[model samples]
Target: MPFVVPRSPELPAATWGSYGMTTLAVVPLIWRRRAPVAVLAAIVLIGGVYKVALDGPGQPLPYAGLIAFYTVALQCAPRVRVAVGLATVAAVALSVGWKTGTARELLFTLFVSAAAYALGRLQYTRQAYTEAVEARAAELERANRIEAEQAAARERARIAREMHDILSHAVSIMIVQAEAGPVAVRRAPERAEAAFEAIAETGRDAMAQLRAMLGVLRTAEASPRSPQPGVAELRELLERVRASGPRVSYERTGSVRELPAALEATVHRVVQEALTNVVKHAGASAVDVRLEYGAESLTVTVTDDGRGPGGSSSGGHGLIGIRERAAAHGGTAQTGPGPDGRGYAVRVVLVTSPQEVGT
Candidate 1:
């Protein structure tokens, strides 16, 4: 008989199947963030025993053990992290030590534990930085939206003020001149024709100014020149109102100095709105207009002796608009019965020194 060496006992079919199953068993550890401590514990208990029995001490399943350790380190709270880390280190060390019975087995286990901790810290830091960047970007977008809305609101206010200034003054004069033209025609034909002509001229001038202002508003591009009205235009404003029915007198006090474009326009508008109300509401024969310029402010007062239309002092949208204009400029307006108990008086005072406007 040929000398046949006794064949080493072959692995049983059941034992081989169990070993294959054990290799795949650690894969679920990757989902440790969803169930950190539980996954970690399960992986260490099952895989630690399997590796000791299968591969004897020094080597464990490479990716599976590393992933479980890293997940526990990153996802668990500090106290839980410490507990999981110690448990994993001891389990791995004992598994290897039982098989190899050597110090080198423990050293290899320690090295893997250290690498897992470092990787976990890196992942945690990366997540924190990403969250912070997202928060900052959201805040900036909200601020930008608020600023854009505010800018649009300011533009609307500017357009309203312009309309009030040009239309009110023009229309008031038209009403008065139209009313006076026929009266003059009966007594003085020459004066009547002049009044009619003034009416036409005022209408044409108002239309021109309105068209210019509206054009500036409609066009996206800058105008050939600025469309702002200043104190220099006050003379023309008064002349138009004078052409209306009320006998008007204008007096200026203090230094007749140049004012800011916006302030000048606002003052002009205040006076115009006041006189318009006078023409419409006050059944007076004469009106007095006063402009006072001081070191720090401009003041305007329009008074009439005629009885006002019997109603609440709240004239209409016109009065509300005047108040809004004054408030917008950090100023104030008051309209009530005249001081002498005769008619209505509208007074506006505007603070006008070097300061930011329309912001």
Candidate 2:
């Protein structure tokens, strides 16, 4: 607050003028944030005038100059700060004459002015650093939350696919067996007994698979233990369909080799879904299925002369499901007319090697 070590006596004749000058310099500080540089400039100019016009030589001291220096230090950039601080020091030093013995006051002014600038600079730097750290923490928290949501979505999709595959295939066969039970019972009890047994088997299989999936959701520690359906189980799937309806024939073009579990499952699902559509939508009496294995990939095609409008095939989620499975494995599925142009056909091609879809 005191720039001079020993205070200078106030000029009695100009006491009111001195009070006016101090008020003009310090009061503008309330609006410093809006016009910081302007306020500092006004105060500095007024301090110089107060020194030369009112106080006279050998009596110069910073009544409000110290406050101005600190405000400028915090608000201005580095270069402007240096200019304002140095100019302030020089203003105080040059105001006093060399003949006067006020060397102590000059030295005190230099130390106080430099100290004010340094303190203000320190406050600015600390505040800036704190804000940067808080902003970085907030960004990291947002990224982690987004990643958690994505993981949850993927899990839900997996469960949906599992339920669809298990229930749709098993339920389709069971429904056919159930409907024929009454008719077969009237003709021959022997055939009706076999159909009843088949219905029970399919229902039991569906229940077991459902339990496995429910276990996974019950707890992370209790995961799905049963082996999932794959290409190896295609025979069972085809046999089950044969017992139901829509005669399906299967043929292999190349040697069958071991493949990824997910890839095998994708193949099985595509064919199973295709055949299910044949049983439900297609009025065709027979369906043809083929699996072609190559060095780089595998291809499967299912065709049937189903009696339906052309739009039903693509308008449903069935085609989308087939395409998603193929594309997930870096492959594709296409649907159009059959080889004979009399029915709907679905052909799927899958690359042997796994490729990240969106990485």
Question: How do all models score by TM-score?
Answer: 0.83, 0.75
Worst 10 residues of 1 by lDDT: 1-10
Error of 2 at 147 (Å): 2.8
* Each prediction's number of clashing residue pairs: 1, 0
| lDDT assessment of candidate 2 | 0.76
Q: What shift in Å separates residue 263 of candidate 2 from its native position after superposition?
A: 1.6
Model 1 agreement with the true structure over 47-136: per-residue lDDT tens digits: 656654564222335667678778777777899888877777777677776768678877877897889888998899898899899988
TM-score of 1: 0.83
| Candidate 2: residue 113 Cα off by (Å) | 5.4
